[model samples]
Target: MAKEIERKFLVRSDEWRTRAVSSAKLMQAYITVNEDRNVRVRLIDGTSARLTIKVGKSAMVRDEFEYEIPVQDAEELTSSAIGIVIEKVRHRVPIAGKTFEIDVYEGFYSGLVVAEVELESEEDHFERPSWLGEEVTGDRRYSNMMLATNDLASELIHGVSHQAL
Candidate 1:
């Protein structure tokens, strides 16, 4: 199992765009979810796909099992997903040596943008970009799982974000 460790943040402005080196459209959905784990499938740029199983309860670390699956299989899984299929364009920006994947959501979750930096360990150092707003690493509300499964419109309609962080 891969030990996944990362931190999440809200994007404050468009400054990160100037630094982004690459971007890819992503379509992902969950097949199963629980307090401790989730099974998900992702279609990247509609050409490749991956099935991922994330286990563990730590806020910054998890046991991640990921596999490359046929796009057809991924499409089948997505068709029967438990909630809304997540649509986003992931922008990769290298800041101070660490690459941050900034996810700009579309569809029902439009207007939401988040940046994540994967780390080798929970205590590893990562430089925060000026465009980074607030750290939302442990906040479940900003989680992709919650965004897919919850009725967030009511919670977020007051403004651009419920976690407008």
Candidate 2:
């Protein structure tokens, strides 16, 4: 069992773009979603795929089980997904000796950008980049699961302007 601990923040500026070391285009879909657990399949760069099962209620910590699978299998899973597929470009940025993943959303939720940094434990400490905006770590509305399951973009940020950079 892998314990996933991470902090999430909204992107305030594009400064992180200059520091991005690598990036990947990802498409993900939720196969099953419950209050405490969820199953997700993600395709990376249209070349690789992974199936992840996460269980827990904590906003910053969860039991995660991920396995690589054939791209074809993941593609098939999308048809059975509970909601719309999510599309984004995730950039890896190294800052203050830690790596952060900046996800710039696409498709239905285009222009939405968020950054996340994985930590070793809930008590771990890290630096917050200037490009990072408000910390949305515990905000359920900023969660991928909620964003995928919910239909109203207005609920996330009124008027959908948050969808723009």
Candidate 3:
């Protein structure tokens, strides 16, 4: 099983935009979300699709299993997803030998922008770009799974502040 170790942050500025090497539109939905595991289906650029299963309890690391699937199947699964489908454009920006995935959200999450960097190890150190905002690595509210299932208004009303950074 492959392990994924990553850190998440809110975007502070648009400086990373011009430095991005590429961007792709993505739509993903969770088929199942539980405390221990989650099953997700993602359609990328309306052409490629993947089915991903993530297991583990830690926010910083998880055992991830991902496989390519037929676009038709992904589309079907997305339609029957449990909650809101995630829509975003992912921009790939490279800095200091690491790549950061900046997601510009769309649909109900239009104004949210988040950046994530994968690390080889949980203790690995990485450069923090000036555009990176507050670290939200362990914040469940910023997790894509939670973002997909909960109402954004409730999140804000309940005091989960998305502060300007």
Compare the candidates by lDDT and give the number of the best one: 3
- The candidate scoring highest on TM-score is 2
Decreasing lDDT order of the candidates: 3, 2, 1
TM for every model, in the order presented, reads 0.93, 0.94, 0.93
Over 42-99, each residue of candidate 2 has an lDDT whose tens digit, in order, gives: 9999999999999999999999999999999999998788877888999999998899
Clashing pairs in 3: none
**lDDT (Cα) of model 3:** 0.89
Instruction: Report the Cα lDDT for residue 50, model 2.
Output: 99
lDDT of 1 by residue, 1-165 (tens): 689999998887888888889999999999999999999999999999999999988768999999999999999999999978999999999988899999988888787888999998888997777888888889888888888888674564346554322
lDDT of 3 by residue, 1-165 (tens): 899999999887888888999999999999999998999999999999999999998999999999999999999999999889999999999999999999988787777888999999998999999989889899888888998888773553242235321
Off by over 4 Å in 3: 153-165
List clash counts for every candidate, in order: 0, 0, 0
Greater-lDDT candidate between 1 and 2: 2
lDDT, each prediction:
0.87, 0.88, 0.89
User: How big is the positional error of residue 73 in model 1, measured in Å on the Cα after superposition?
Assistant: 0.6
Worst 10 residues of 1 by lDDT: 156-165
The alpha-carbon lDDT assigned to residue 94 of candidate 2 equals 97
